[model samples]
Target: MEEGKPISNIDDELRQILAEFMVEVIKLEELVEVGRKFLVRFQQALEFLRRPSIYESSDLVKSIAKANETKRVNAYVQAGCLNAYDSTLSVGQLNTSLSDLHDCVTKSKSIIDELKNLMDKAGNALCMTSDDQLETEIQASEAIGSEKLDGVGCASYMAVIYSMVKQDYVMQEKIVSSLSFKSSSGELESYCLMWSLRPFINDDIIRQALKQVR
Candidate 1:
């Protein structure tokens, strides 16, 4: 960003980074498409395997239910730990009031409790098979795609941020500082980007998509 730097050089470098970021975005889209297809096939497999007679007689249903429950708990615990890390950063660097992480975790647990209550009611009202649960999960996923992933504004902004960060050390520091200032309460909002994106990242699919691009 220095005045003396040649504008053409800067433009060329920026264009390169922009192209790379767009390629990444395209790979992500392809990964999402493959993941959707995988999910559909997985659901079909579950449906074929979870016929009423088979599901009632076999332990597979219970095993899957338990596995899903464990997965959800592990996800929540990981999220809480990440939140704690963010709070640590805030307290250590920003000299902010130490966040009450216990309270935050408790609030998260309360939300889970409410969801469990809803699930219980649904379970009582209807017979739930693993296939049915798979369908419900797919529906919930579609809802999330509609609610959060529907917007490209955040993605484009992120691409800009990525390009900025790929610049020289001074520029990166300035960019981070400016972002922190623009963020709420001087907190580093950028720290949450990768964590927020964890749910959407499919490493295997991404790898395959990248291979295609290469």
Candidate 2:
């Protein structure tokens, strides 16, 4: 009976750890969705700032375009239509968008930290169980399908996702920070495209993560 008690305890610990891991996976999925929304908002702001009228009306844009006579003709002609173009609205929108993006970055950082902690805990738990036992327990837990993960596979999967998300957020921060009155229409277009494409994030991994939650 005494020897069996250790086995029972290990089983209980495994079950509890797997349960907690699944909950964290769900949280990660939700956090990723929030990031997606932030990206959409950022893209919209970029699009608005990129409009020909808004872009050409900026005093800074005019100054830069002046150095290139070819661009100056188009920019000045557009600026002429709105002789009293006030940049206050554009500036305000830019400030608000940047502030919101900063908030998103903070939240993303928090989520990533939590994921790291969870991964560590999972790693420690992995030490208590053998490969075969861990695989069996993971399959029994049914949080993620047998084909999806075995042993520390889920933890590694989440780590990969967290890494990608962290990189994506960093990229977004750079793009948003770089935007200014001096940004050319072409630069703005590229920024918007990059945000939408999210080259750092993989759709397959995202799908796999989503399946874990369900």
Candidate 3:
């Protein structure tokens, strides 16, 4: 970041990139809201379709179990993305981010594992459904929502996973890897992370966050 230079400096590029990233963050917030709703409703749907008299003999329960896993994996990926992105900025310049990305990932995994439990519960209830209800809820919902032609919960979870993890976390990893640094080891992974977050985070300040966390 030299003074009176016609070319763009790192600070300038960082501001530009951050502005772009915020647009996606806006989308993430909305998707998270939608995800929160779907989790609740999907659970309710399973509870209703689980009545012993209704689900006594059916394969519909199986689908619910699968959907639960689908959703859990999606949320888990999102959590990973958040951890990765935050880590990029959290670590110090010329130093690895203060918080260990793997540690944060481990903590996040615990929360996401709950989705697995919900799925198991739904599966047990589905087995009891009679043929008619199975036809209605499991096979019949094909025409229920706007996605009449596509696979159901799978796509929803897929989209969520792509948004939270790949779009931000995995993608950012590539950018960090691409960045070139001066006179430093991979410790400069910290500098690369800070580059993406330059707009709101002063270099010195981010340096401290990385140090504090470390």
Local accuracy by lDDT, each model: 0.35, 0.58, 0.33
- Per-model TM-score versus the true fold: 0.27, 0.57, 0.24
Write model 1 residue lDDT over 83-135, tens digit each, in one string.
Answer: 44544443343322112222323343343344334333333323343323423
The 10 consecutive residues of candidate 2 with the worst lDDT sum are 129-138
Give lDDT tens digits, candidate 2, residues 93-208: 55676676667667766766776676566556556333343333433434555344443555455456556766876776687667665666677668767777878987776566
lDDT of 1 at 16: 40
Q: Mind sharing the TM-score for model 2?
A: 0.57
Highest lDDT against the true fold, candidate: 2
Model 1 clash tally?
0
The lDDT of model 3 is: 0.33
Question: What is residue 166's positional error in candidate 3, in angstroms?
Answer: 3.0
Task: Please give the ranking of all candidate structures by TM-score, highest first, separated by commas.
Answer: 2, 1, 3
Runs in model 2 lying further than 4 Å from the true structure: 1-79, 83-86, 128-148
Please give the lDDT score at residue 117 for candidate 1. Answer: 41
